[model samples]
Target: MSSSMASSLPPLPRRVGWVGTGVMGLSMATHLLSAGHSLTVFNRTASKAAPLLDKGAKLADSPRAVAEQSEVVFVIVGYPSDVRRVALDPDHGVLPGLRPGSILVDMSTSDPSLAEEIAIAAASVSCQAVDAPVSGGDRGAREGKLSIFAGGDRSTVELLSPLFEKLGVLNYMGGPGSGQRAKLGNQIAIASTMVGLVEGMVFAHRSGLDVTRWIKAIASGAAGSKSLELYGERILRRDMAAGFFVHHFVKDLGICLRECQAMGLALPGLALAQQLYLSLIAHGEGNLGTQALILAIERLNNTRLGDGGESSG
Candidate 1:
């Protein structure tokens, strides 16, 4: 953590509410709990939140219940619809239960416009909202090394700096929906990069080059990328575990393409990547890791990564 990133406002062990305890959310919430904050968590599936409950965090029956007990609430559910359901639904949402002046931080990758809508709704209730989507995947979340892109009131963001520092480096983008827009741009870059990464792997494997050695040799060169470093060995090991799910990546890419189309932009590479990911979903590999993109490329070329045999797909 940088000295400048520290917050002198909120004190330690503040009341923190966390909604969503999925793969990354569980790890993120654990960091705050470990830091001694009074954590209250709510997940749709109570069983998934068992770890936090065992570690001394309180479980809430609903998002509203979590907000009522927390000073600062962080939400990171899947899909924009889930964001709406948890953040804005009048019956059981976080906004309905937020005390005046409390902050709601949504870290989900969602539509930029929806972030703006949430901010507006939060303000109507005399509360604050920040759209702070993160990157670095499950490994980053577990290690507390995520890149948090935050957007909303600068003062509110600064006030939450203490908590943000515990999760990762915070990059204050701008007002309202800027954090989500920044994340969309991130997805655009990642979509194309993933396509290139898998294509290169397929080519290397097909050429009879030792693909693992090839990755090691080129990883330090100009061809190196964060995605390559993160997924290369996993790809070689045929590990399709969900560090980041293919379905989630597809949702992100769909958002990217919609945003691009709204801006009157033409991004063929992004479109192609989205289609490939969609194919994964169609083939029932939606629950797999994003690195399973290699399977699609392999199917296209009639080759597998290690065995050089026909792809089962």
Candidate 2:
């Protein structure tokens, strides 16, 4: 349908077990708590989780503890390995304790296969499962404006709709593994677009054009994006912060490359983007934001930032 006619809403869980208190998870969970859902949270680092507890979210001793106490568990950890450890660690796995009729939503950017395995494991416990990765980053999460891509059974998707609404705009993409496929699709698109942005900033600088004017002028037109309009200046100036970590993007791009290889598709731009990202890592820029790829691009063009990279958090 038309853009304005499309609803923009996020679902709130009835009771949520929010695992992985990282940058995005904290804010998303906060939205649910604020929506009046009872929430129990667990983070490996207790210090990072104390704030939620103080805000009236119940604190759990572990992932399993959180799962046992809540009807729905939402996880958004770092990697596939971490997702495996926290969600299915044999001794105290969330899988063993999650109540029947409960659901487990993995919001981590993980291997698609891992999502399937979690689904099977959840089934064994008579619980439902889905992989529902999010986008729109930390700011969106805090503002309750993320876009959630979910994959699972139709019934489960319907049941979870309200929860997704409270957290972000929701799209029930397809059956199992579809959420991850959509996420991979997004990464592929992002890798290409970000590399192009890097190249454009580098070009503007080497040409001695008023980069602010050049970038803004183009951005005001069809070439604009949330990434460019928001992060363009920071990337152009090489002012890297920790909003969306370069290391995290590195991991995501790597996954996209693997998916490409398995499909026997040639993704030269993504390959190039991966190379550029790796170059940034090799030069110790991993902790910087993914937009820091602009720095590497500038170095390749043998130039410096126009105004030395002014920053915003």
Candidate 3:
């Protein structure tokens, strides 16, 4: 959207409930506070919820409290299971306390079907729910440059536009559950791109080229992407720290693969990439970055990246 067009956006809703305060959530909640919105936040772990509190973000005792306290409740929990629990689990769930006319925005990447189910459940309580899963990483969250794919009513989406802008670029995919579907697409692209990166790096190293420089030179070209550029250095330096965990990527890919199966489609690259990620978990590199796939590539090529020894691939 154009700058002038965005400047005319309706004011953001004043009260926001933010659940899930991990790597991406903290920065996102901080942005809303900076934008002058009142935020009530909750995390299963109190400490993960602390930094926001320090920044003057209010802390809710539970998800129910968050739901009760805000006009909009934003959830960015960890996995599909957690998403279900946060939305539907009785007692601790946000559903019981959420008032009518409130909106619940799920920013977590999870099953689209489940997200739609959440929408239905929220509606029974006279509330609206949308799946607005996000892209961009910890860095993107911190920089307020993430890409959000939202699925909801057009008017309601417009109602939340300012909040979305405060978070990142926005794309309105469709109604109810399209955002999660699009996010599954995002994971497919990311997983396939990483696999291609692994292949290219392995080929370059086997051809006796300076792998690091080659990746740097080629990544800016049409063949490269966020994954390649972001992960290239990690692959070269063999940094395995979790920017996003390998296990999560595997889970994302698993969602995509399931969707593909249900759609009667076939994606060999996605299958291979999924297998590679599962292999990494089996090798006990589940907590490493998605770039840890390079370890798998090196193993297939019978090579190593300096002294990061041990089969924690």
Candidate 4:
């Protein structure tokens, strides 16, 4: 999609409902709301959904309430379990309230198998479902520049194009759960790159080079990457605020590793990254952003990012 304003999106759906109002979901739902779509939103925690309410979105009491009121419902919660609870739980979940021809879009980075399960459950109710996990993190969501990988029927995907375009570029992978597979593939690459990024920065600091200057020097060259360009400066500044939370990335990597095992593949790099992130989680830093993986590296080497202070808890 181009840089057109989301408010200019035409052929908007009759009513849009959003579930999950956490970090990423809040911005994504705001895009639809700003586009003048009639939006109803629900989150497990009411306070977190308050911002959307202030922006003129109506508050729904539950996922079922949102589903009942909207033609198309979008969910971007925390984990596969959270997705299942909001989307598939028998009594109060979205599925119980969704009309037969309505659409359900799951934007969370979650398990491929669960995506398939949701497809089946929605199918049983004659509802359409799409597993459309996203990338570009919080910055992308807030800027409406997310890259959405969609997996569902072609017709359903095309029908949702105008709305998806409002959020970001949309690529249709294949049948149910394929979006999740693609997302896991992305996580694997990011996992390896993060390790390389942190290790390179550690080496630079150990060698007495300016870490920030080193990043700028190599960022435009062969060593440059999306991760390096996006998160390198944040790492240098020790800004651990979550563009994407370490816990969430760890969940994504755990999914990737499980998928690898199912396919009889051994990706040692991904395994190592997972281990390192788990260490961060162990230190009660799971709420910190993925950039905080550098902290784990610092612990291993008994060093710091730039100023050589003790690693903060």
Off by over 4 Å in 4: 1-11, 307-313
TM-score of each: 0.94, 0.91, 0.92, 0.94
Candidate 1: segments with Cα more than 4 A from true spot? 1-13, 307-313
For candidate 4, lDDT tens digit of each residue in 1-313? Answer: 1112212223456699999988899999989889988999999898998988998999999999999998889999888999999999888899999876788999999999999999889888878889999999888999999999999877788778988988999999999999999999989999999999999998888887778778889898999998997789888778899989999999999999899999999999999999999999999999999989999998999988754322232
- Using lDDT as the measure, name the better of candidate 1 and candidate 2: 1
Q: Taking the tens digit of each residue's C-alpha lDDT, what string does model 1 give over 208-303?
A: 778878898989999999999899888888888998899999999999989998899999999999999999999999999999999999788888
Candidate 1 clashes: the total is 0
Off by over 4 Å in 3: 1-11, 307-313
RMSD of each: 3.8, 5.6, 4.6, 4.9
In candidate 1, where is summed lDDT lowest over 10 consecutive residues?
1-10
Worst 10 residues of 3 by lDDT: 1-10
lDDT of 2 at 5: 15
- The per-prediction tally of clashing pairs is 0, 11, 0, 0
TM-score quality measure for candidate 2: 0.91
Identify the superior model by TM-score, candidate 2 or candidate 4.
4
Please give the TM-score that candidate 4 achieves against the real structure: 0.94
Best-to-worst lDDT order: 1, 4, 3, 2
- Tens-place lDDT per residue, model 3, 1-313, is 1223322433567889999998789899999989988899999998988888888888888898898888888999889999998888889778877876778899999999998899889877877788999988877899999999999666677778889999999999998889999998988888888888888877777666677667778877898789876777777777778778889888888889889999999999899999999999999999888889988887887886543222222
